[model samples]
Each structure stands twice: as C-alpha cells, then as structure tokens.
Target chain A: MSSSFDPSKYPELKNLLCSIDKIPDVSDIRPETVTEKVIECNSNCPDPRLKTLLDNLTIHLHDFIRENNVTTEEWMATVHYLTDVGKKCTGSRQEFVLLSDIFGIAALVNSINNPSVNGSTVATLLGPFYTGEFHDIEEGGTIAPAEGPGEPLLVTGRILNTSGEPIPNAAIETWEADAEGLYDVQYSTYSEPDHRGRFRSNDKGEYSFRCIVPIAYAIPDDGPVGDLLIKLGRHPYRPAHLHMKIEAPPVYETLVTALYPRGDLFSKSDAVFGVKTPLIVDFELIESDEEAKAKGFKKGPFRRLDYDFTLATKEESAQAKEKLRKSMAKKA
Target chain B: MSSSFDPSKYPELKNLLCSIDKIPDVSDIRPETVTEKVIECNSNCPDPRLKTLLDNLTIHLHDFIRENNVTTEEWMATVHYLTDVGKKCTGSRQEFVLLSDIFGIAALVNSINNPSVNGSTVATLLGPFYTGEFHDIEEGGTIAPAEGPGEPLLVTGRILNTSGEPIPNAAIETWEADAEGLYDVQYSTYSEPDHRGRFRSNDKGEYSFRCIVPIAYAIPDDGPVGDLLIKLGRHPYRPAHLHMKIEAPPVYETLVTALYPRGDLFSKSDAVFGVKTPLIVDFELIESDEEAKAKGFKKGPFRRLDYDFTLATKEESAQAKEKLRKSMAKKA
Candidate 1:
C-alpha cells in the first residue's frame, strides 16, 4: 500500500510524510467496529507506552461517547469550550491546568505517579498560580511583603524521612494567598514576588517562615472552566491553603502538596480537589506580646502553625506506585 | 455543609457564585475513590443530560488513566497537545474538529446520531475543510471555475427517501478538492470558491452539476493532530471524496456525507476514518467527444459520477438511534 501511493503528483508531500504501509481497514466501520479500527490504526506507534496510552484512550473515549449517547451538538459545544480554555491560557495563566485540576485529573495523575507510601506527604495539584519567579527567603523570614495585609503567621516544620530521622537542607518552595483572597500574581501592578518564597531547611531539617495566614480564595472564573463549574453545580473556591513543594535531593521523591488550615469553609470540597485529610493542620492563636515578638510578629494575637513533612525515598515511591499498578493490572 | 461555608469574609464573592450546597467529601481521595468523589461532587448539576454526560466522561477517563497507568508526563503532554489544537483554531480553521476526525471520534459520533435505517445512506463526519462560503449555482450549471485545474467531471444525483420516493427541492451543498489536492480555501489566492457550490434538487429530486474530479489530499499537517499521526505511524491523506450536505427540511434528517471514488490509494485508510464501503462509488471514464460536449465539457476524456442518496426521515433516524441506545443500555 505504501508503494501504491503515488507521491509523484505532489512534490511538497513527496518525502516529508511517508505514506503509511500498514493501515487498518476503516472502510466498513460501524459503531461496534470504529473503536477497534482506531486502536489498530495506532498499533504501529514506535513507543509502546504511547501506543498503549492511545489504545486505552481510544477505548475509553469511544465507550464514553457511545454509552452516553453524546449528541453532535453536545460534542461540538464541548470542543468549543475546550478551545476557549486553551485560548485563555497565557504567560500568567494556564486554563488547561485549571481544567484538569477541577476535573480531578491532575490530582489523579499526581496520585498515580506519587502514590502514598511510608507515611510520606501526599502530593496534590500544582495549580496555575505557581510561577518560576519566587525570591529566596531565610529561616524565620517573611514571604509576604514587609508591611503586607493580614494577620501575621508563623509556620515551622521539619522535613523528616519515614524512619523519623531528620532530612536536613531540603529545598522548600512555599506560597499562599493573602488574607484578601488574592495571590501576588492576581494583582495588576505586580512587579515583585510577595507571599511566595524559596528557601532551604536548616541542618536540623527544620524550616520556618513568616507570612499572612492563608485564606479561602476563588479561582479565576472568567474562563470556560469557570463556566463549567457553574453548570456542574460547583463553586470556584479553594479552602485556605499554603502551597508547598519540598525536595530532599538525591534520595527522596519531591513532595508537591498544600497545607490546609483546619475549619476552612471549603476544605472538604476544595474546588481543585487538592485537600487531603492528613495535610490539614491547626493554627494556634497566641495573644502573648513577648511570644509574638519572639516569633518576629510586630504585635500579639498572631497565628502559629506547626506541622512536619515526612519524605519517602525515590525507591519507596516507585515501589509503592508499582504495587498500585500491579493491583490495577490484576483487575484489568 | 451549606451553612458551613462562611463566605462572610470575601465580599467580592458574597452574592455571586453561591457556594455549593451539597459537595461530597474529597478529603481521603484515592484512585479507587477519586472518580466517585468527583462524580458525586457533581451530583447537583441541574441538567440531567449534562450530568449523565459528565458522569460517563469521568468514568471512562479515570478508567483509561488508571488502567493505562498514564504517567503525569503523558497526561500533561496530551493536555498540552489539546491546548495547541485549540490555539490553532481560527476564523478559517478548526483544529479540534480535525483532531476528532483523525481519532475517528467525529465519525463515530456522526454514526451514532445518524444511524442507518432501512437502506438509508449513512451519515459521515462534517470535516474541518467545510466552509460556509460557497456560491449558489443553478441546476445543470458548473460549480468549478471556468479555468480550474482538474479532469472534467459531471456529478448527477437524486435525493430520495427510504421508500424510494423523491425528496423534492432538497438543499444540496457539494464541495471537492482541486487536481492539486487542495481545497479552494487552501490557496493563498482564494478570493472565490472554485470547486464548491450550494444548489437545490430539481422538482424531480435530481441534482446535477459540473466539477473537477476530486483528488486525494493531505490534511493540514503543521498542527498537533498531524504530529500525532506521524507518531502513530499513520499518513495524513484523505481519499478523494466529494463532500455533500443534503437536507429536505421538516421530514428528512439532514445527511452530511461524502462519496469516495473507487480505487484511490487512501480510500481503505482514510486519514479521518470517514470512509464507509457503501459510499464508495464508481467514477466512469468517458472518452467520447460527443458525450463530453453533451455534458458541457470542452473536450473528451471526462469523468461521470452518478449516485443516488437515500435519506432517512427524521422519525426513522430517531427510531433507529433509540433502538441502538436501548440495545446498548441492555448490555450496560
């Protein structure tokens, strides 16, 4: 069939796209046959991983379309919606990642790739707000502006391995919304990074930073994903969360997670499905003026949050993921 | 839960975007529980059909992800590819539809919604190449430009119903590629439609027009869908086919279809998976001078294609689709 294709007629396509030699016969396609035809068509993918992914994608997508009886108009609407979401993405925003977050796809993918093991921190969705522009801060230093708005907060945590030993000098990236439910990037005249910082744990595996208490915030809802949330009877609010990415180089798998302060309105139903129970911690209110001064707060009645992050070595994480994969394979 | 979400703090979100009243607890998510949690979270969607669609979509998508062990990198790649496709769509092009076409999703959706009934001609994908810019021509008039490039051809067809009755004055829109395997819009100098026209069937339900013989063409390959085809070891050429959209108004279902001339190298493996055996027709080579002049061509060596389109009435099509749905439901 490859030799039969007469590319002599069109010089532009002559050697650029070699005509395929083996094509599944898609001539007699019916509803029952279309899925197989599409799958077999992709059987020649050079990467086995990609081939398997496409095959499974074809099977599930076709089954969903057929089983749900998705009408043409509905499908077209969906396509249009997706296009709008993509168009909404720019240097400062990523609507595709937002869509995945709300769909729990990003979380599921994160969970699958970084399954829970050895009591390590559970990974969550790395949302659209993370930027590559965080400035470094020292221990007990503030991530928020020097005179930022909000109740002052002190967060202290140590990075530890599964064996309860300190894993010192781990790199940590932390970010949070201000008390007004806005990130630094959400501001129009944002020049310098605020409320987000990169720092490393001390030799004692201890990490501490001062910032405004995290607050429940609405995700940007002007795009198609926001429109979808409305239709799905969902709200675009995430509970008060401190985004954290912790990495102990060489051995431990990096942990991407969020610390949700307890008793937030939206914690149980975070818009991005980012909250896990163990990651929720307490915020103790301290009214002692001396204690506030000691913690670098300007005044009393500041909040104190103490939590510890556990790390799983790379091998532990891989073995955990492999076990889950084997169990899923058995079901399949 | 409804009372628990204290929106008192954020006045901006005060009256707008009411926090969801019933949200499933997503606190302890796992692969085994995430899909259901997400689905349950959406249980409050007011539109039942949308809910059903979302539910099926969630089920199949999660299953595909888990079963394939789709890694974060792979899923991210898919998401980014879809984003690129959406970004590529403009006023003159639709990359999402093209993506759906090559994946056979568009064809399968078309097949499902317009299931064949009692000798009715099957419907096919209304591909991305279709445009709303064709000029209207009279019966027996030529659709191709006076000096267009291609072998001369006459297309004569009648729109009929399953009972063999003429569907009079049906609106017909027909389009085809030029000899160079390019649509009129594919050209940089596209000021007017050359090989496409909108016309109506005659009182006798016959539609005839002069056009160039369609040629197999490569779909636009500079986009993500094209990249995917290469990765899947597939070509980008669609078989030579004359696209047609026929509608007889209030009684018959609109028929979106194309006729693939027999013996095209890409027919059995149409890149968009739009081929159906029943739509493959014979293009007779007529070399007689008299016949060519009678058909309004300037000389001999022209082609003649004669085919009849049998459409299903709206009711018939609906019944066929319902029957299929019921059967599928039984299986489910």
Candidate 2:
C-alpha cells in the first residue's frame, strides 16, 4: 500500500493496495518500449477475457498516436471533446452512443453478435431511444396518441420460427418518431411515453399496432457528437425506420432490430449505420376510406406495412455467432 | 440539410446542416465493410491533416474492435466508464490526463515532442500537479513554509546552453509534495501556495532554493483512474521527485521536467511513466552543522541536490523534433 493512502482522504475508494505479488515490475519506459511496459502492467488482470480486451485496446490506441504523430494539443482537444460528450448525457439522450453510431462501431458490434442464422430476420441497431417503458396494449391497438402528428400507419407482422411454424406469446415492443421526425422523448412536451407500445403475439403468431408514419430524423445535433459529425463534413440524418425488440427468452434469442423504409434519401447513408439490405421495406399507400375506418383511422391514404419476422432458436443463434466469430478470426 | 432538422427544436445547434455535395454516399455496411464506410464518412473533412488522422483512427479503432470481438455489453461498459472519467474532472483534477499518463501515452507524447538535441536534457511527463501559481522568490530563499512538514533540503542547479555557456535570467518554477506525499493543492487547509516558488538564474546561471524533501506520492485515488490502476494490477505511486520548469522562450524552448531521487522502490516503475534514467539523481547527505546553518537550515544533517540542466535553442529543438517524428514514421 502507498503509505500516503489515507482512508479519510479518499473515502470513495476501496483500500485495494494489498500485496501485488502477482504483478511484475516493468522496466524503464522509452518511446519504443512504453507500449510494452504498459502491456506488462496490465498482464496481472484477473479476468483473462478483460485482459485480452484491454491489451488489444492499448495496442490500437498507441498505434493510432504513433501513426498520426498526434500532438499534445490535438490530444487535449480530444479530451475536451470527450468530456463534453459525457456531460451531454441525460435520461433521453446518449451522446456516447451517437459517437459510436457515427463511427459505425455500434453497427459492427451488432453484426458481430447477431450474425445471420438459418434464414432468420437480420438484426440491426437498437438505437438510443428504447426506454422499455411502454404499457402493454391488446393486439390491433394503437400505439400512437389519439391526437398524434402524422398520417396513420398499420404495422402487422407474424412471428415465425425458422422451420416456418408460429411462435406464440412473443413480446414485441415498438417506438418511432412523429411527423416532425422527433421522438416523444425528444420533446419538452414529453411527460408520459408517446408513439410507443408493447404487445404480444397471439396463439396464431399474429401482431398488429397502429402508429404514425416514421420519417427521417436527425440524431440529437446539439451535443458534442453532432459537432463531431459537422466537423467530419457529414450529415446527421438517419433514414425513416421503426425500432422493434422481440423476446421469447430461454427458448428464443431476443431479436433487437429495426426496419427501414425504402426510398428515403438518407437510407443509403444512414448516419447511424442502422440500415441493412434485407431490413428495408416499402409501405403501401391504402386510399380506401372503408378500410381506414375499419382500422380506426379518421381518413384514408394511410400507409400499410405487412411483414413477417423469422426468429432463430437460442441454440441456433449461439452456434451461428460462434461460427461467424471464428471465421472472422481465421480470416484475420 | 436534413429536411427533418427543425431549427426551433434544436436551438442550441447552429444551423450547420448544409449541402454535403463533397461527401460521397457510402455503400451497404456489413461487418467486413463498416470500417471502410466509416472512413469514407470522414473523407470530406476539409483539413487534410485532420482527415488523415481520422482515417487512421478509424482503421485502428475498428481493427481493435474486430480483433477483440468486442460485444455490445462490453462496448456499452466502456462508454459508461469513459463518461464516469469525464465527470470526475474538476478545476484542479484532470482525469483524462491521468488516463493518458497511466497508459504511457503522456510519456510517449512528451518523448515525441521533446526529443533530445545536442546533449540537452531529455523531458518527461509534466504530471498533474503543476498549477503555475507559485510566487517569485529570491535565490537561496526558502520555498517551504516556516511550519512545513519533512526534513530540509537544498537544491542548487545551473542553467546552460548546449555549448556549456551560462544562460542567465532564465525563469525557473519548482514545486513538490509535502512529507505526506500530498501537494498543497490537494489539501483542505491550502489557501496561499506553499512548497513552491518561481525564481530567476543570476548572471552566473546559478539558481538555488530551500524546500522540504519530497516523498513518494500516490496520484489521486478516489476517482475512476485509481479504480483502473487497482484493476490493472498497478500501483499509483510515483517516485519522489521535484518538478521544475525552465523557460527562456524565443531563444530556447521551455523545458518541463522532474528529477527523481535514487533508491526509491517505485523509481524503476514510476506510475505515470515519468522516470528517465538520466533524470535520476543522488541526494548527498551532509552532517556538518556549519554548512547546514550556512544553508539556513535549523539542523545539522540535511540533503543536498546539485544538478545542472542543459537546454537547446528553439531552432535546434524544433529541427530535432521534426527529425525524430519523421524517423519514427519511417520506422513505422
């Protein structure tokens, strides 16, 4: 223990300066050997998995500095930027997620963990908006508020297994932005959750909910992440998409994914990299008043989306994730 | 501009969503191609230098993630950890700098920026203790308070140019921790600074001051950085050292460095990677009452540190830095 470590001086910290017999002393550090010294410093981590992650992180972080010849000024500026990013976090906003999203790291992690399995519906980003606070509604009920701000859309989908059989009682939660491309959570008027709902698949595996048409929306642009995007000369627009999460648990691996609307300008360059080829769908415009009335809409010309989600069993998904990871490692 | 970007909704953001004609739309992103996509997202950065840095950053960061197969949970954990680190910063404390120091990045940056030139002194980490707030003191005056802690020590050094000529009137600032290994800035009782002083070299390039001997100190251990050190199996102790900054700007580059005492256990592995072999010095113990009283100490036995610093002219130092950076790049 450092003799100077007074418990009263650092009440927040645990007295962890015990025997370091497991840690090896490092040699003198120079530019050429500092990375090695740092690596050896981390070699005493008890968790082997965490140790590997930190080791790789150090290797890449140091390499970035050396390759770019990054100056102290540039590094300090990055530190300030990151500090601003952290300060911008709130209950409804996550600037760090936006940071990862803009860099496509979130997409890459999604791809790595949710690799394709047995023709199941491809998964995408969970985004930064899922609050998991929606009240459960009956099938065919409306998730949109009674006085919502957009054209009504009816989303109906059947949950099926890879072998083409119904998977009943699966929970599905969905959320989206209003006509102004703003989520309820993004508004000052937001009190209770809006434009979101939870429902369960019936015995026939059918699910339906009424919602406003999702529009292209910008990720929060008043934060450090937005500043970074602007500095990179990129737009902050994500294509129109509906966020969905379905879970059967124990038997089925929960599917966290989204569906993007086709023909959106930003679909080709969704700021968050949440778009995948298979996840894109077209909404058919139904202009029949009789059908609209049956669907509890006051008028016609509402959008209609009919799709089916194929889910992979837990065992199948585990196998696919391991196989893909091993294959990627082999390729590397 | 994104059509969904409403100015009223995001009043904090400048209306920066302009034409991205310079930004080419990216293709479909997959695990294998997300890195390429993200890199191209930054291709439109106007500053070519910044663009290169971002490109290289994307390459290395993505490589780290893919090579390690970082999962969403692990990535989110990292995000939260960074947020905590940022939140821990204050007027006196810089958690980010500590983060860099422990990883040896601060040392690497210091090494890269201040490469040796013509037998001039090598530099090390400036550390997080410097406040640049010391009051001026006459040569041979005591910097320690009348009722300070620890044994007395006398520090005398000469400032010289590379050719061994005296560099008169160079301003030198020095500071150190108390016997308890804590700086005045770290204490609740601290108001006016103690144990630090600023002085100028005389015509003979001689500078001297009296201070209490600095003891090995632990970096702030109540924060996220201390928690990280414990997890990494490393100690937070830096060797006992006196921090110094000598400036003769315009003619010579300012030098910010420290002198480590020999025989300290942590000297070989300074927690912040600030130790350099050349900067380690032996403090001679003198038991002569006449000499001790002559140095204005209250007692006989006292420690004396006599070390001279050699500096390079600004032009010489700049050339050396550029040469080292280029050579490092070539080696990489």
Residue A323 lDDT (model 2): 87
Q: Please tell me the TM-score of chain A for candidate 1.
A: 0.92
- Structural similarity to truth (TM-score) of each candidate: 0.93, 0.93
Candidate topping lDDT:
1
CAPRI-style quality class for the chain A–B interface of candidate 2: acceptable
Compute fnat per model. 0.56, 0.48
Q: What is the clash count for each candidate, in the order shown? A: 0, 0
Q: How well does model 2 score by local distance difference test? A: 0.82
Write the residue-wise lDDT of candidate 2 on B144-234 in tens digits.
Answer: 8754668778999899999999999999999988888888888876787878899999999999999977778789868998998777766
Note the residue pairs that clash in candidate 2: none
* Candidate-wise lDDT, in order: 0.83, 0.82
**Model 1, span B139-229: residue lDDT tens:** 8788887656777889997899999988888999998877777777878778887788999998888999999778887898788888888
